[model samples]
Target: MQSISSQTSKPEWLSSNLLLQPFLWAMSWLDYILAPLQNLIGYKRMAYFFVLPNLLIFGIFILIPMLLNFYYGFTGGDSILLENRPVVGAANFEKIFSCQDFFKPNTCAEDLFWRGAWNTLTFVVFQVAFIILMSLITALALNRDVRGRGFFRAIFFYPVLLSPVVVALIWKWILQYQNGLLNAFLVSLGLTKVPWLLDANWAQFWVIAVSVWAQMGFFTLILLAGLQGIPKEMYEAASMDGANKWRSFWNVTLPLLMPTMTVVLVLALIRAVQVFDQVFVLTNGGPGTATLYIVQYIYRTAFEFRNYGMAAAASLVLAVVLLILTIGQLLFQRRQEAA
Candidate 1:
């Protein structure tokens, strides 16, 4: 009996020892290197030493690229190499803005850019509004004491884990005009087949809807956390005052959830502005540039058109817009906190 028990335990002990040995050996080397550094820097400043690697990485990958992009925007040439390009001042921006009228895209020198800008604006407005509403509704429903709540939450969140390409491909398959699932279902119900992606109006609508559906889960989770953080006693007090569910939600929940909502709003806006991958895969900015957002415009200009300077200019404009949005969010949050 003792020999049998020893045999069974041997594998488990050996497996743990194998894992532990490598990890312990690595940690000992880390300690040995860090000890000298720690002594040289002092404990209080050791934090900065540890952070130096991340700062270096950020400078190399992010900061340098951003500066180069800014410089590229001022240049004009066929070549992407900065040194080969000639300085063109604000010619690209002037071209983009050169129009008989601001509202008339056809009048502009860079009419495609204007078209993309308008489409992006429309998409952002509708998409952001729908995302906020749907996520809030879903979060509220999931927050309730319902059976299979955890299962349902996971189901809703599953799409967020999917790659943008995968999401587009799945929907593209489902919405195919010939022999698609949705069209087949409609035909079965004795309804006429709709050209979901072929028509400009339908294509634009579905793009926004698909974008909202894909992103709603992440925002829902954020709002759910905010909802969970609210003190239960507030709701109890509201009930004691004879407030109904609607009244309680309006007075208590909305106020407390504003911060989270602001976060979701700004994040959704930024993502919506940068929307390209899924829409590109799904629509390819087709049906007459109806779904051509700014990012896609920049992409086509750079790679397809081989106009690197124009693409860089457009990207700089986009970056400025994003920076403004970020700063606005920070200011809003500061004011909210102060209040």
Candidate 2:
């Protein structure tokens, strides 16, 4: 009876404790300040109040810059100040879009821009496909019951926590043409040193390979989570229907995993499109611009060449592409939900 009485009084004792008094006081003060506002807005409309701060931040940092970028894309000058810039409407777009043969980048007035566009397209195509395939495989392998699974999962995910520059630098050392780890291994095996970075083809290959190695872990984690969320009963049901393992995976797992796969695809595409840091640090758009992507082109134009207008124009193009992709993803998600 005494123990029961103590348990019942414990909550009251904790609430009246000196250590919690300051926090309670602070909360009371906050409530005092918000009381009038809450009364005016009502409980249902209070979500807007909570979101106001984040909305303001997004407007200032993202919305404002996007508007300014669009404005600057139409004007041309060496000056960074918008007031000092001359309105050369559509000229930047014309310069970028003009080409005798769209396939031949050198035919364009802004050949470097065209080159960067082609290179970015090529990179996105290869990188997104490879990353998705590799990530799915890794997730599947790790999802199974295996020895040292936790350790292997950590090992795979450790690289995603690293800085992009660090990942690039690490791979740069490993793949360097001369006096690098891979070259040393080749030399030991009585093979001539292969110029991985010096040759344009090999440079692009290494850049893509390194990028996949660095980022695949993140996607793997996402897919693994999705895989684990599937009900064990679904597989049992498939087996009861006399479906083989492969057939069950195709009929049950693939359909169930489509939403997660779509998310991975869209995110991977966006990341591939915005790829800059890894390529910048790894190859620096090297071997005669073979690996130069659109973001690098914009950076070079804005900072190196002092062509802010052109850079802004290129950025707008990139923004449009990304917006379209995002919209498409949303539509796809909606359709998936409807179905």
Measured by TM-score, the strongest candidate is 1
Per-residue lDDT over 309-330 for candidate 2, one digit per residue giving the tens place of the 0 to 100 score: 9999999999999999999999
What's the TM-score of every candidate structure?
A: 0.90, 0.87
Badly placed stretches (over 4 Å) of model 2 are: 1-52
lDDT of 1 by residue, 1-339 (tens): 988976775666666877789989999989999999889979999989878999999999999999998777888988988789999999988888799987879998999999999999999999999999999999999999999999999988889999999999999999999988999999999998988999999999999989887989999999999999999999999999999999999999999999999999999999999999999999999898999999999999999998888898999989999999999999999999999
Minimal lDDT window, size 10, model 1 = 6-15
Model 1 compared with the native: what TM-score?
A: 0.90
